[model samples]
Target chain A: MSRLKVLLPSARHLVTEELARGVVERYDEAAVGEHTVDFERRLDLGGFDDAVSAVMASHDAGDLSMDGAMAEAVHRQLRLSRREAADPGIWRYLAIVHRPEVVRHRWEYRSFATMRTRFWRHGTRFDANAFSRWWWVAELTVMAEDYSLTHRALGSSALSTHLFSRQLAWHHPTVAACVRILADAPGADVERTLRVLGKMLGLRVAEAMGREELEGLVRAARG
Target chain B: MDDFGTDGLTGGEDEDGTHFRALCKDTLFSNKREEGAGGSYGLGKSVLWIFSSFSTVLFRSTLLETQGLGNPRLIGRTELGSHALGPKRAFQGPGWFGEETKQRRGTRAESVWGPAAAEISGALGFQARNDHDTGTSICVVGFKDPTADADLGPVELARATRAALAEYFWPSMALPTRALTARTEAAGQEVEVRPHDADVAPFVTAWESYLRGEVPAKAPLTKPGDMTVVEVPITIPRTHGGEPEVKGRVALVVRLAAKSSEPRAGQVAFFRGPGMVVSYRDRSRLALGMRPFHAVLACGRGRWPRKPTESDLAVESFLRMSEPPAHDRWEPTPRLKAHYRRGYAKALTELSRRVDEALKELLIATHVMGERGPERLQRRFPIGKAGSPGKGRSAFGMSGLDARPQDGAWSFSGAIERKAGEGPWSVQVRLAEVDEAGRRTEEVAIEALSVTVDAEVVVEGSVASVTVPADVRVVPFRGTSAPCSFTGALELELAGRMVAG
Candidate 1:
């Protein structure tokens, strides 16, 4: 009788249980010709790549402006070529793990994309990813539907780095809009606006503001 | 780490070799300008090479003869080591010893150089036309990691370069601003910069306009208007609902209005507290009791449509009186109840509204801030929420499991109480363990255990007390057992007090 070997995952290996199971279930003895074949080839990384590809693909169809915004961010933060850096599809592969709980959950699956999403969902885990220039553009630049706000949010360095680092940024929805409006101001005006807004908002204003209020702030910021 | 000697000067010494070597040098070569010197003396460039093994300089200076043309230069040298058998050792590397005196400037140029430089430059966007006049531009050679570079996975090289720039540069680089300017282009918009300093005129003008509009000799929001004097009952939330459901009330006039000149329109004030007035100004952030004014205003607002509720009145009046006025007029060492009457009441009402928001933000930020260094935790332990107690000790000098002061020296202990999830609580307990020299034991529990990081364990069987004899050395004695000797043993037990009333 032949002995079956169990493969242990890597320390950096990130995936959720559901994703890993979905990926594993897709493979069968007949379909998976050889045991040595790469698992990614046989199954989707639990729609990780699909999700990323879909997001990037939509930039042209959804909001070209958003694509431009993300590209600018890539150029600023990562200093990468805008054409290559603006792709939203690339984010799916990189997970933003905020907590030990998220890391634990990621290890349960084999899909990198699932890990990335779960990581990105939490503020703590999601924030560090934003500090990394390349990943930051990919994370904040990619929008769910409306790319205009997201693009504008990405273009402003103060909005992206300083404002986002503030206590209020957890109010991401608000943060996204605030940057958009402020992005239009001259460098001096933008700085002044941000400083004033910062002072008025004080600390933890985002959390204090209602979802509606945050959206209002965002609208105000886009001026 | 050993990826050395992969530069252009592969062959030997020639005028071309000298020129090529000069090109590979780390410094900007000649950046002596008349006005504001934009570039450094290649010192920063040298530091960049030391940290990250990259040897390339790109520049366009108005001070140098080569001002406009954005030329890429390769400048470096290969030095010999005394320990080596041969004259020259296997590439001891570029910019290894210090600043390379002989610099060779490269003649390569790229079109995007001007725009790229302009984006980061806070000053004039001088195009590179190679006229050795002034300014500077340098690019450290980058490592090609196909795997990471595939999608700009992580710009390790760029981060290192940024770090290098920050460390070596003397003056802080001001980021270019674009907030107040507008630029239009056929294809793409141009970036602009703005100053961060205050616009003095607008601030002063706004203040003057405000004063001129309403010279309200009677300070705005301070005077109590047609406030009906009536008593009302209130129910503080369960979260903040103290032992007494109904606290107390105060009968005072209340006023609410929308006015001109103010930043936040809605303003409420109280006149009966310790000070003459209490106000609550609603800014973007939560101002629970930021000032007595806010608390009074919130309390006044809460007790609307009817007379003031017991909780509202108590909190309103408490916050008014409890808040130490600006002039240090509020009596020092005021009774806790006197203070709590307002402080606690105000706290309850404010907590009712602000606690949840604070909690959410706190939790999210805590998770996001990432792992802080142990040193930071240690530093914060004395001043942060963790060090709430200790009778205002400020800093607990010892960093052991626990420590207590007595006799002359501070004592250490292994006995600790770790609650389920509370923290490694710090207790002021006398040690069963001995002092530096051999000695007997002494028992003392100076203060109650204060939990910091988490709830701690109640090491059930390990709890023991020792009596330290005055004259004996404090060191652990071998072959000799110290009998348990204390008023009580360390254990987790419920007291008669109940937190929830």
Candidate 2:
């Protein structure tokens, strides 16, 4: 297997707003692909470009949902440690250099303002980036190398946004219990149930609560 | 490690090179350092020797100019504390390597140069410098820093060293003019340390915001990632100069961290010209429940929006002179009398005080009139007199009346409300149990009365006299009902009257 080396983020790696604009105004994968990045060392040793391409291809064919698949693809292919994943630079490099075609295809030829944050933005790493949010979702939801839970959570767009869009995602087990219960309870009105639970959980220490207790509270709120 | 040539060993020949003598001989004094340089007290070099278990260090420096016989110089020094050699003999306890010269009083040593320096450096396994490079490298022969860590091994020590370097100098490394790159090796494996490492990523974001000039000039922080820039003006009173005062401003860049997980979230990285962090002051109390934040107080050349002028340099020197031998904090020391006029300390105090005021403006939510919800809730209570029938037409009255009868006494509680206009309510409450003939049975002593508004509450014997602000419509009060001795039918035996004045 071939290992891929990545660059440490620097001014040279800056994907200027102009470059993102170019990607939008004139859709040129070749111009985006031709930009070279100087790699320092192998913090991310995964050779997963093929995996990313396969998902985008399948998504275009309507064979699979994009979000859950892309999330699983990133988590499975990158194998990023928690330390490496925290850096927005790595995700920026991946979105711009390694998989520009995929990012462009995923978000499509929209306004530069809309597409700019999908690639790079300062201080919005967790929420703004297309690849980072997916990987973090998988990382935060996965149970001991199990991506099954992540799929269940990301399977629903409203559930993911309602739960993980806020700081409540940091309380992993609380989020996990909510995802588990909401995923199982049919017609649970995920948004309405979660809105009520989000307020009640704020008053209590959700992190310290057990899975069963949180699930029970969530289940009760569904009623 | 060799990256030397342009600024190699200086033998203190030229005035610009006098820091060489100061580094070796003077313990706590600074040579005439360049403006915006760090190490004001020149004590950082001592850490090299102090970190070593044997109090010894080796050096190899490439020079741009030299007073010695040859170019790059090599030396070794050891500082064993002052101790005795024999019964009555004592040694000052500092030893040096190189050529010894007979001075006017005794003997002294100087660093070796050229072939001799190369020979010693090669024997100690020091790397060769490129012909174009210029810098100095020192090796703590028996390296150990108990305070940094309890006996860290090569890898752990290297990691700790890299972390400290990145943590303190992260702002410098993240800035557009970043000039430093640090690389470390342990057991033949090299790790390049960068500022955007996960541990310092938040700080890097904060410094990047400052460098990008993303700070807004006003209040009410819009989002978590928003930052506000405030100028902390520092005016130094000069002892003797062309100008009587040096006016300069340092930018205090305060940014709310994007997440609560940001390390050292509530600390303001305090530093001066060299951009080495002197302290991380905890100002978390300023905005108690606001989102965790990271701040940078850049003084001296690190000031933003402009380059450091000659006046800024003068203020930098004044602030540097105010620091103690440790250089950990800047303050008005007794030593300031030599360099600054009277009341020079006020600028330093203002610099510290300005940080709190600026942060509060950005993070602390200000009180807006009529915005508080509790005031609106107070208006919902119906206006009536406390301990009276619902028939008082006064401008201010009480409502939500509750007089719990237990053990032949009443535990009274109610909310005071405004009926008409703005003024004070001078009201009196009486507690007594009445008989069927409308006669007083027993007096219920007024133990305690608490009004939420600022008022003079005088509880004399069994009656309570109180005054409250008419604008504050809600004042929920409750007091203890003393154990009573009058035993009777507690149903229709309670009588109370609230007198309005």
Candidate 3:
């Protein structure tokens, strides 16, 4: 398994002109390599571009209907190919150098200040990077060869938001999968169902249950 | 909020206050104007709406009417995502926070919250201005947690707000007028925002000095060195007709330190009218020898309109045609390109030339060149001798040369010698060869015979010897000549002054 380490900013300061200028001037690809934990598995720029283009095409064609699933698949595929090079620095490089145009295209309508954060920072928080969120959501929710369920869950905003935003809820894949299955059922009110499950599961239940037990709990919540 | 008490929330009724309308609505590109004075794009004001959890903000303004009477107004507006309420019903999210006004001549009736202006103002702790006071105040309701990390309550949000105000509007604070003052209420204590604090003292000082038409002697993060200031003239071509020329000045500060801690040292900030910094150019790309330096250029206010009229707007629009939407960078328009060529580029080149000259003079005055004298000489004059010949034979029977059975066989040697009481000097000997056609074809170096000469003596023999100096470097011959060949007669000539034995 490839582990990507991300360094959060020491302080949550606004990105100023001086800060932006400093970051731009000091950024060096070689320096990034030196700091990377996996130096040997550096991402090939051409391959990254090709993968990005393919994902963007699928996004534009509406083939990737579930934003959550699309985010997951892109993250999983990109990470799987270059497992060793999975680091926050690489993601930053990708956001700033490789595909800033695509990010801007998707998010220019929002405030410029908000857009700056999406393009600069990384993590799994509310204002974490737009790209990192997709990668992380996919990494946590999708099991081996069961991306279809992840897609269905992501299509429902209630399930996906709860899964992605709450760290404890999504860490247990069985519980997450059961929630997705219940949300996908006919005549199910996803928002209310998620609210109830959220209260019942809490943090302790999420921590304690394995796949089978979590699935049973999810069924009991449904009942 | 208490410092300028009694001043109304609005500047005045007669003043052009429509600029604040952009802030009231969540409209994209609403403030695009021909002139750069107004908002380039309306997205900047959206930060206020984004900060509110409900995407709502309240505006309260007390204005002086035509009769100089105080008229306070309050309004609430929100911008929610589409389909937030339901699929069919969408809220416009605008409401007056006071009683509705009755219809009058040339005006329609409007609905407002049912409360007296004074009551509302007092209830919200918005100090009501006396008859003379006029200004504006906005309250963003239900502020979202601005913290990027864990939720830290309202204190973190207050700090973030103060920091943002300080960083983005430091230039405004540095102005003589002190254009804006921000205060925050956290933990029941109001704290004033002071962007001109010690952390950014250099920028503050530079800005103040720039406004006073004086460039500081030192750059932001460099020790004092040679500083040069020059005035550059700029001409803005009017879109409609006339051309206005503005005088700008460029100040270059050479740092005393060899390395600079300030990353912005080599950048030149370009200020527009009223000493407002619009953008910066990295003039370090000029390949100037002086790396630890900073330059600043400011255009006089005479170039821009003090209060924009229609005609002035045309000029401003024309002047800023090439400016980006954020006004953070200058794009290349034909007019701007011409201005750059005439003003910016010329000033930078001249400053760089002066810096180069000053650095060279400093190096020479400090005797730094003496340390590199030997290396300089070695590079300029390579220590070697050259000859053109097919072959040569040693007359003294030296090891590597065949002893030619000829009438005239010549050999020469040259070396650089340093005497104890004299500077280093070069000594060389050359022998010329003459062919049957009576033309000199080649020259060869002959070996000098070793001999100890206690006094000046002309030694005539097959083996010529010179006394060896304490430290001497023989100049090796660098010529493509064969070891054994005799073409013509050989004549020996020795050059350079001889040292006393």
Candidate 4:
């Protein structure tokens, strides 16, 4: 972990800029507190509002972890959809909010009240800024280019996935799942099963199996 | 919520009995002429109130086209009774609920402004500066707690705040490091940027392997699989320049320590290169543990396409060079030596030399330990005197001593003479081999024993005491000689102890 550093002042500044943009998009400020004072003098909305709106839209679009959808929404909103948006630096905020572990709580169908009660310790940050939330969601869920497999496996459990260390959440999902399956297999045979799997996987024969096939094997074995 | 009346509600007292007021700036504009710009909305102005109660907001603008005279300033106050979005509620109407003063900008210094700015600035640990030319300034006092939701201790709260900022506003973070006002002085400032393309998958795999103890002794050095090579010249130039030595081959060697569960696959080495490429590499793939090591070597050889053929003489020579000479020996425990062939010791001695050369290469590359570490090549085997295949021995013609082994145990007995003022001298009484195979041996338990007087043995009452030098090599014995000649028998119970002295 990099040594502890404070970013509160930076946070305050960034949040200020964002909130300023948000206020312009949500309300008409030319006539002061009254929104209807000069309805015709509507201002052009800034990228910040567009970002928030995009995040909200993405959240509305899919049952992909609400966080993932939120992140995509933010990416689209920020016009970073075609850029290096998945880069760790850009997506840290989204990961914090839409982590697989947190997403699991949403997916398991918990009540809004229970969810809200857990907000102080859970997804409360999602309400403040969807773009930031979505970025973080994607970061925590996808470890590599093969995010399709990670998406299938994690489904909505993105936030539920604990980091090996709070700082290190980057590992291939397939490798992680393979390890997990071996770890969870029944009885003292777990070692034997792991040995078999290791030998099989180590061989060139099973190298061609795609993620779906791998997941299928896991499911069949679990059954 | 019950109201705690204005008694403890206002901040602190000011110098002239007037509340300290701070100047606040709203980047949000109030005019339609400025509405088309990205930051024209006055919502930014409300954040000042969200921060402080007694504040003064300065509205400054530089318009491109002027239809106005006053550059109009709408400096106003949205006080403690103003409309606010609650912690868990949305903002719909104005009320005196007093949870927060969302955007209350006052005109000038009032009886409540100074203390309010101090309170808010202290909580946020920030300072405000005004740019008098064009931008705005929104000074605040009595600012509300931005982190009221936090339940963490001081340290944890700081950590949580840092984590959040690092995750969210990282790109535009003015202060890159997460620093609390109190700590910034002693620790200095810092910035933490997340890695761009970190592949943590390899680290995790390596870690798990370590926990399982499946980590090979050489495994800790595992790095991302990459093809690398160390080049060695194949040609020895001769006087006739017909073709100095155009051919060269790259070879790889691996050394693994012997283990208890399985005997180490004897220091295996594989040869490749000198026209070697893919299909040929397949031939060696059948050798377990050899393939990965080969793959690693081939990858190091830089863009080399195909595997080398077995018939390639230079390649064969390179491979042969990688193997240890046939006579190195690494000392083994007695049990290990028993498992090897009688002639294995000589062969191991040769192998030990080659292994030393290979380890030397690794040491150079890794700088694991400094140069001049212990060399296994210059080692020697241990030598010592052999103990008795004992028999009864005569000491001054005194006989009747027996030492024998039974059920893995044995015993010894003898006689000594006491004389005055002479030092103790030890005698050898052991069975000597009388046959070629050393099988026909008999003990000197009583025969060939004599009374060779060496020490002045002193008799003290029933037992005799002798002083032996500290460096003397003998099992401890009692009695120094007195002025009288005294004879006594010594008895010892030995349970299969080997006598190396």
Candidate 5:
């Protein structure tokens, strides 16, 4: 049986935000709200716990950076489908109730404001919560079955931010194509290209485009 | 009802006339209340008129604030839904009762005072209280119950009122400091409603235990009256307007009910520091095999165990402002938004989340507390790492040596390599989709494909099969994934089966 379940009404709202802000304050206790049971499958917390511990130890042990590693670890252990990855609540439960210590250890307790957004927030805010941010970066950049591209997309914080910030980059194939451009055009202004491309993608529906058309747009932006 | 009436309704008084005007006005005109006062919104006073079928209510009070005018004061107010007193004359709505005034230029109506007020109060069958005691007596001329049949006798009304008071005000009735004492009269027989009454006992015990510090944090609740407290966090955000972020907590008080059919079971009463029950949340459906229980989600300064800090006060303010006009729920209200920034809405959800989360802890069985997820859920999800490329992935075959999107299709080209003394193998490749719920969609059609290899290829709905001759040292292969439109993310599932050498 899966020990993990997704919080329904999948958006950021009251119970979700309270769970977020109170994540550190009431980290050990489960949130008081409705959650999926039999209809929505549960997740196993054991392997996830192990993965989280490995990341935390690695970060504390120094050397091998754990951002991408944790991203890979969570992605591998969680194995959430693309749709499950989109729900900010699961990331909230994962970070807050499931493994808040890792979030605190990784993100650090800056302030309650940071804690609020890092746990849960309203609107198209996948970037705020610590777990969702990394999970999404991996999801958008990983090729067919390879996470190597995912590692490269997260190679540097700046590179990851530039790619992650763009709406077009949220489209998996478009980001995969853009990430390849980042690897190819070594000296190019990757940030400027992606930013300009994001504005353009915002004007158009990027999801409807295939990889070839998206790559063409990425190459055009390189000019 | 027993004593203490310092503030009284004063007429013809300039400075403290709010008491008189607000009580006998068109609608409740009093919106201002000092922080942590036992009243709010002023909408509560209207309940007297609402419960009265005559739309009329009479108030008689002994004076302390208005002692200069006289000893006792009597007044009446009615709120009628615009009706015709006679055939031609129409009355807009509200009207007052007391004395006809010649000095006041506006409405001739005014509160009656002194010996006449006392005589009239007695004639109206009002309960007699000590003359020196300062308080107001409100008589709703003909009380109404929308759900009840016609008119209930005084005894039934008294019994129902007692039960309600016990259910909602058990904490106040049980307090060690003596917050309030209530008595109900039925059929000319008066009975004191104690905290130990059937409807009130469980909650009273919870409050008594909590106040006595018998059950604090994480205490086990084994028997009846045993309780536990969980502090749920409510953090208010800082805005561009420069209010610094404030962090606070709402203490969740949960008590184990004595039996399954207890009236308040699976219900939670939420209140603030003012010590009044604000609302009751029904959680009956959420309770599973857990013990039947009632809970109290106490917030603000009044409910704080010790002296409240600055942050605690801020939390109280946050919650108070968030309350709607009904004051029954803590949600993002216009007043709350006007005071705080836009993002404070999360606090409401946080509160709701805490209520359920706290219940999950208290109501669910202790055995299931540490129990992990359901059976066989630990297996790797099929998309990400299931058929994913990995180190020491001894699934012997050149499946996806290189894979990329080519000409709007997934192009997979790899050579089939096997060591000497190895058998010929059959390779299977399938394209699958993940549904909205993160589960893989059932395998559909994948035959709209292009296959290029020096071997025979067979196509099934979502799977592709290829057989390679054992003699070939290495066979180069290339193929396009699909022409079938798949909406969600797709993953390629690959498998290899050894034939014979």
Candidate 6:
């Protein structure tokens, strides 16, 4: 498999009044394709849409468990085929062109200034891009072959957004598992716990900690 | 932190204490110039009353004795309203929480309440100073929670308060001798807020740099008058005849560029007299194509009349002309807006021109000395076909390059055109090295060249032609080892016709 080569538009074109105005207009797939740099081995847009449909269906059916499972599935699929879809512009194109209705539905109440930001590449915050955040969160928190833990961890919206967007290390599966355990603990104040964890992570003490050590740290932190 | 102390809230105080009543009243005050005499609008203090859950503030003061030697008078007052009750039951909020005396009569007698001020001050952990000390302090009782919905903890609230004070009062704080001092107490530690503090260092730095003329200076207008001016010529339609000339001074200060998510990188802060900012217009409105730059256009104090007449009120500097109730912005009336727009248009145009010139100079300096510097230098010079005289067209085709700097190497590229059934063309690249001012300093010939054409060469009795090929390296310069300072233009001659890139 070859990496996707997405060319960036000039900086001037990004902030043009036309682009700002176009964000609210109906999606034009052809215009998006014209602006996007062509490359071989693109992500399977059909399959991606099917996955999104399945997730939205689950959400409609009130089956809350499907949220993290869907995120994990999408991440696993994209990471296998065209892992370079992680690049911001590719995801931006997917959100704005491939599934703009979903973007609008999710951010209907947001101001135009905020709605426009959902289409751009902001620093570090995966949630800044509506579609990429799901993949990134799953990639960061999912234990190998057991997405049950990912679901439990992502149960708390604040915890999931903060961990995936700002704080968590994707490479440390043990830390992810420990945080998942802490998140699912009965009556856990996930927001406060994440805030504490965020502060501790800044101090770099958890870098060498194993799963057991991290569990102990979480327990002590709660105390 | 130590109580370095301040001049205190002395807006209405005098050494003789004759006008001390001004401090106790809550009414709109304006001077002859119609500018805020003691305090602007006199409604700012009401924010405390509104923010106090009990609608009361315990005001304490130690006044300096002006006459015979006597103990300084310490007084306390509270102002409240009984709006819930009938008018007959309504009570004036004022109450004297001080020593009882026969002299406290009339309104003072009617309003005075509570025990001696010293006892109350001591109970509240407030210091009661003697004759030597003279300043006022207030303890807001039942203070309302300002950030009720913000969910901010004590630490967050402290940080936010520090930042807010820094941003709003930075101009006053930046002065060498400030009229007031502000401090914040958090976690039992008091920290003084200053202009150079972490929260507001950038604003302070920009302000200081502006004062020192390290940033761009305000351009002066040519018109003869006592008023300083920086006129920008504009072509707005005039009712009388030709375009009416609008004049103004615009001072600009450029700051480091900020990312989109960060706070605004640039703005134009308009001010009236006393350097109070009336409005802050963001850079997005100006649409200047340069990096973040701040501009200021303050109406001269002399422009405002001492007593506002009809004509005086029409002037842009008149206090009531454009100021909103909050005094935070200038939303001019239609007539005043027209005059303001004329002046503002001129100021912005002038600022944009200066920014463009500065950027060009910076680009030349950076490109000349940066890595891969020779390649980067090409973007500055114009590219065109040779023998086209004057200057060549820029990349965007907006304007031609004024003069290429003579401190860097030049690179040129062009194609060899062969007329059908005519002949194959021979090409030579020429170099002209100019001095710092772009005057032809030396005409240097190409020491080495690598030329490749799209077609095969055929010379039959000086009439040659070849079919263009798929792969060709047309007029490639195989790395020049010449000295880097060889600055000038490179011209490509195809079939004895000069072409430029």
lDDT value, residue A186 of candidate 4: 40
Worst 10 residues of 4 chain B by lDDT: B376-385
Q: Which stretches of candidate 4 lie over 4 Å from their true place?
A: A1-48, A51-65, A78-83, A86-133, A136-155, A158-207, A220-223, B1-501
Rate residue B136 of model 5 by lDDT.
75
Pick by lDDT: 1 or 3, better one:
3
Looking at model 6, give its docking quality level.
incorrect
CA deviation > 4 Å runs, candidate 6: A1-223, B1-23, B28-39, B63-80, B83-119, B128-133, B150-155, B179-186, B197-200, B212-250, B255-263, B269-279, B294-321, B333-501
Q: Is the docking of candidate 5 incorrect, acceptable, medium or high quality?
A: incorrect
Clashes of 6: 7
Clashes of 5: 18
On a 0 to 100 scale, what is the lDDT of residue B171 in model 2? 65
- The candidates' DockQ values read 0.00, 0.00, 0.01, 0.00, 0.01, 0.01
Report the C-alpha displacement of residue B117, candidate 1, in angstroms: 93
- Can you write out model 4's per-residue Cα lDDT over A1-223, one digit (the tens) per residue? 1111112112222222222223222212222222112112232226444554454455543354454444444433444442344333233222222222233323333344332222222221333223334444444454443344333333433222321112212334434554355433444444333233332332222345666766554444333
Model 2, position B153: C-alpha lDDT score? 76
Per-residue lDDT of candidate 1, residues A155-188 (tens digit): 5545554554454444555566566466665666
lDDT of each: 0.31, 0.63, 0.45, 0.29, 0.63, 0.44
lDDT of 6 by residue, B240-271 (tens): 23334333333334344343233444554454
Segments in model 3 whose C-alpha atoms lie over 4 Å from true places: A1-223, B1-38, B64-69, B80-96, B102-115, B125-133, B145-153, B179-181, B187-192, B195-199, B213-228, B233-235, B238-259, B274-291, B300-321, B332-501
The digit string of per-residue lDDT tens for model 4 on B1-501 reads 001111111112122221111222222332212111111223434566665544423222221221332221112344433444567643332222111333355222222223343344334433332212222223344544454774445455445445543332222221223221222223354334331112222222222232243444322222223122232323212113232332443332232222212221222222122211111112222322221221212211211323333223432332222323220112333422333324333433433344333333332111011112122210100001122222332111212334343333323343422111122232323322111111222221322122323333343343333333323323322211212211111122111111110
Runs of candidate 1 with Cα error greater than 4 angstroms are: A1-47, A50-147, A187-192, A203-223, B1-501
Worst 10 residues of 3 chain A by lDDT: A2-11
RMSD of each: 36.7, 27.8, 31.9, 39.0, 27.0, 24.0
Give per-residue CA lDDT, model 2, range B1-501, as digits (tens): 334233655665224446466666566666757766676667777887888888888877777766446656777778877755478856577777666777787766677778878778878877777435556778788887758636777777777767877878876666554545444555566665576775656666767777777766543344566666778788878674445777887778777776666677778888777777777888877654445778888777777525777766776777777777777788778768766777688888987888887776566432111111233222221122122332234344445555555665556676555544333445565555433222344556777777777766788886677655435555566665567633322211112111111
Which residue segments of model 2 deviate by more than 4 Å?
A1-223, B1-6, B12-17, B67-69, B80-93, B100-108, B146-149, B175-185, B212-216, B238-243, B259-261, B371-378, B381-501
* CAPRI quality of model 2: incorrect
How do the residues B170-262 of candidate 3 rate in per-residue lDDT, one tens digit apiece? Answer: 555565455444445556666555665633334445555555656533212223433434444333332223344333333332322234466
* Model 5 whole-model lDDT (C-alpha atoms): 0.63
What's the true lDDT of residue A98 in model 1? Answer: 14
lDDT of 5 by residue, B104-214 (tens): 444446788887888888898777766567767778887787678777777777777777776666666565554444444545566766658666566667767777777
Off by over 4 Å in 5: A1-223, B1-6, B10-17, B80-93, B104-107, B176-186, B222-224, B238-243, B257-263, B282-292, B305-309, B359-501
